[model samples]
Target: MKKNKIPYLLLMIVHLGLFVVTIIKKKDKKPLLLYYSGIGMAYVFEYVVLNIFRGYRYYPKVLKRNRLDSVFGAIVSQALIVPVSAIFITFFQLGWGWKIFFTLLYSGIEQLFIHLKVFKNRWWKTIYTLISLPFYFWLVSKWSIYLDQKPKKWIGYLTLFFTFWVNYLNINFVLVAFLKRIIFKKGWSLRKYYVNFIIAPIYGFIQSIIGVIVTLKNKKLIGLGLLHLVDQLFYRLKLIKMKKWSVYCFLPIHIVLLLVGSIFKQQMLHLMSESECSQRETKKIQSPI
Candidate 1:
């Protein structure tokens, strides 16, 4: 189905609005208010930019990263970048050209973490955040005088492109890996590959919202609720824990990857569809028991 645009746009506006509110009230200690808000806002923005706007491909696959560590890691990572990105974009008035360039550069630097095993090494994970930078700014820009008048219409397309890859990475990668960690901690005995590879995607989709809920209540069940029986198992097995405000890794890899991927996604999709159709007519696939 063709992607829906309105919900995505509305979500983006909401996220940017919240982000703005946080910036305005940066001086105030809101007691985990921003962190909780960021979780819902981030998911919405990430979903909208990568899934709703752009039609790039993201498989429903996840990696093997511990939920506890990834959550903390995300917090540490974002804390470092937020000030820098915010300062550059706002005080320095970095335009799209600079934004795009810095986004790619920063992403390449972060990708090192993936390779170094500081985080899971998924191909899409490394680039999608950079790709979203343009989209995020375009949303923010529309509310302010941040863009050139001639490029008005173009911003929507660009925002959409960035949104696709961002969703791909967040859904297809980051969220699943975190869920794997949580599952294992709960002592739900299972093969690692199945946990990280098969069950992870299904759980990842569920946990994406859980991560959002983690904000309202720092406990795992609060966000996702008691859907799975193993809730207490993970709750009991905590080697590490994050205080609700940590998971903000806003690096803008989406904008960078979107620019590159948009050029290729359509062609790739076309080729894949043709290849699949060619084999479908000859094959009556067996159902798995």
Candidate 2:
């Protein structure tokens, strides 16, 4: 293997081994889900920042400048690192000192990758990673603890907001970029950026907000179906246009996004409940007898 590939391969092996050991030791479903969810969220976040936004690129170009390379790299890198880090944070019960140590250690590793040229930063910075990495670890740790709790209805709404935002970013940024490249034989242009970053986000956020309100007030499927109708109307009004086949293709994608949003809402609510429960238990324990 090439020199650059060696680092990624070794990192994968080590992480996979650690992940397996973690699973074996814990033998619990909640942490496992939290770990996997962390991985998924990391992948999606990177897809938006690195891939869609062109914030950075991987060296040795996994698939030689193809979008598939970015996708593959995102999954492997995220799966190798984020989930394992999440497992440590969520299951290991580390104190604040240890948490800080791990956070810095992870950040240092990212710096090492930069040194090795495995990661080529475009608009991304090490400080950003330093800040966000710890936050993600903290979030996942809480999520793992709260995976079983019952959440309030408002939690569902928050989840819907996050899910829709992520899905919208994926569809409008990544998907549109890919299609423009492949079908229209176009390159990245300012217009595309404006549409993907500004227009799509605004429109998608509105649509998803409405969908969530309707779903909460009435039936889920009906509300989701209405979202599809709204999309069609956008096309009819010439706000967005695509071939009939392309529109058909995106229908399932939209549905999947909606389902993911709904499911994630439940998980978020559970996490929220877990945080509340922890606070209550602490208060009770501190009270005089």
Best by TM-score: 2
Clashing pairs in 2: none
Write down the worst ten-residue block by lDDT for model 1: 55-64
lDDT of 1: 0.38
State, as a TM-score between 0 and 1, how close model 2 is to the true structure. 0.62
Compared with the true structure, model 1 gives a TM-score of: 0.32
Candidate 2, residue 46: lDDT:
67
Candidate 2 residues 169-272, lDDT tens each? 45654555455521121234534333334456556666768656764464667766777777776656555645445445656766776676556555555566
lDDT of 1 by residue, 1-289 (tens): 2132232234345545645655565423221222322232344543443333331222111222343334333333332243234333533356778777766766675565444444444334645667665565444434223122222323323333333423433443444354422222123444333333333333334433433233323353333333232334333444112233222222133233333334333333343355456456446464333
TM-score of every candidate: 0.32, 0.62
lDDT of 1 at 99: 71
